[model samples]
Target: MRSPCCDNRGNNNKGAWSKEEDQKLIDYIRAHGRVCWRSLPKAAGLLRCGKSCRLRWINYLRPDVKRGRFEEDEEDLIIKLHALLGNRWSLIAGRLPGRTDNEVKNYWNSHLRKKLASMGIDPDNHRVIHNARLHRSHSSSNATRSSIDKSTNGLQNNSENGFRDDDDLNLDLTISLPSSQRTGSDHLQNTASRTLLLFP
Candidate 1:
């Protein structure tokens, strides 16, 4: 029977990696440098899928991977970062060297989530445990408020398409007629008359 982790190549094992398999993968990666995981199964003689092998390397077997329990500083930093970044664990992980996003996410869900609750904080909102309030805004910025109101009300002049495509509204042009065309009225005007053209 083949394991889910089995690759196209026949040299690999399936399920959890054995000590022998781990050593083989480690040795191959160290010697050739980590590149082209599809070929890794044949190169390292691993029976596991490329994705599984890659994940194992990144999350567990990386040389710089930190071990043991999370420290107080690490916990505090994770909490502070979680408060700012939310569930984007990868970004948060980047800030904390030697910690993977998966590790941080797991630690947050398993440990810090309970800790926050015990401290009367909402893990989701990161807010102090309190009844929700109707947050009414009594903004003093009347200038901005009035401008918004004006814009809303002024829509009457605009088309249903939400565009102020009215030609009259934009026509502020005054044109002067030529002397030849200006001659009119009682007889002939001595001066050229300026005409204001309004589309409306």
Candidate 2:
């Protein structure tokens, strides 16, 4: 891997931090409990920038960090948080104790995204749009009333009254029904209910 950008040869003697360097940093931190990052390099005998030292300490050498694969619960929590926060991996990771944002992001891209896509959901929006005829089978009050009126007019006008001219019938058939009758309405309702559950 590339060396950290903060590493400089001219500083406290650049290059990768060895075990001795790590120990020196740890000892200094233990003794001083963290000084200013800009001043830390000189005090700790590190050639790295303040930012680099801080990143190393927080991401790698932190005493509290738990290193390993995430648990099932952690993965589930990450997914739930990601759906709400989108690409804010740090925010998602915040809900997962002992997990890092980088780790969560990688898992999302590699595993969860694929799983969602395979299930016909848009990984980006977490919604599925299938072109089924049931989705087209909606009904509207005006439409239902019109159909009832047309049928009544046809019955009253004559045997042909219940039936309209082929062209007229075809035109009426093009009207969209209400979305509640659509095949996906149940799914949409479920999603809405889940959202309500989350908040309330």
Candidate 3:
């Protein structure tokens, strides 16, 4: 069986990575390129678990990984993308060039969640909390009013057939048959003259 990622019994290092460890990982990847995470840790001489090594390289050490603060435009894009895609961080990060899913997720949890809540928006559902409450209140009252209005106006507005008197109630619904049944033959056309059969 394939072993667990960070087997506690093993002497695998945990917590923060040092500069030397980082260099070793970078050097190994630069020379050989990423092969397999499970094998990479031992091959690269890293004491870290394969999962840790992979995360370090992808989220931090990769040359293409964008460092420093996220730009204003990037933040806006993140917010909009989050609204559309919900918690699918990897997909959201895909749009913002060089941003890793971990970085984007951390930024959202640390910064954006609070920022949105401050503006009265529920960070989870991305809805205006106040407006949502108001909407519920208004919806319930409107539903009640609508029910009362329908009951009061039913007799006056509708005839015995449960239809408005002045309304054009056409019971003439047409059904087009298959093309095989609608052939150009005169005898067939005569037999099925109208194509549509009406019922009273």
Candidate 4:
């Protein structure tokens, strides 16, 4: 298999691409078209690695790439898609023509995340912060209501059984029966015994 772009780290340039570099890359791609990323850098006379060339071309130098501020509708679509797709920026960018995945991600980090925060929505989960808190409190209230009902039931049971609040009942119960071995008369006797034990 062919080695990765990072394997040849010694000679490749590491910093920002100059206008000359960009022009060379653009011209090469325009003439030959985008092909094998691994071989494209050497063919284009760029000292940068294939991956860097690919990113520069795709993100910046592409003729079709959109520049300037995102439109209002585009912003709304990004919010909606981000809600549904989370951090899948490529998928979100796919829905917006001429937008790059890196652009969308950077926009989210720099702008949209803060925008959502200002609006009291969690950017990560796209939930209203107030609604999330309300849900938690609502759940806790439900639990509190159920506990109150249980305590009331317990008080009623205590009053009926003539027991104090501190008193405890033997609530442990067990049943053992061999249905195949039990005759009709044996079953009746067992039932009668169980009823007496429970009542007493």
lDDT by residue for model 2 (126-173), tens: 444354222223333234323333433333344343433221221121
Give the per-residue lDDT digits (tens) of candidate 4, residues 1-200.
Answer: 87674656588888899999999999999999988888888898989888999999989999978989988667766776665446878766766778899999999999878766655556776554664333223443344333433433353356555656543322222222234334555432332221212111
**Would you list the clashing residue pairs of candidate 3?**
none
lDDT of 3 at 56: 95
Give the better candidate number (2 or 3) by lDDT.
3
Window of ten residues with lowest summed lDDT in model 2: 167-176
Candidate 3 per-residue lDDT over residues 51-131, each given as its tens digit = 899999999999988988988667766665565457878766866778899999999999877666655556665554665
Q: List the residue pairs that clash in candidate 4.
A: none
TM-score of each: 0.58, 0.54, 0.63, 0.63
User: lDDT per residue, candidate 1, 1-200, as tens digits?
Assistant: 76754444655466787898889889999999998987796778877778878988988899988877988667766765565446868756765678888999999999878766655556764554666432224232233223322433343244653445332222222422333333445222224232222112
Misplaced by over 4 Å in model 2 are 1-17, 129-200
The lDDT values for all models are 0.62, 0.55, 0.65, 0.66
Model 1: residues with Cα > 4 Å off, grouped in runs: 1-13, 131-200
Against the true structure, candidate 2 reaches a TM-score of 0.54
Lowest summed lDDT across 10 adjacent residues in model 3 is found at: 191-200
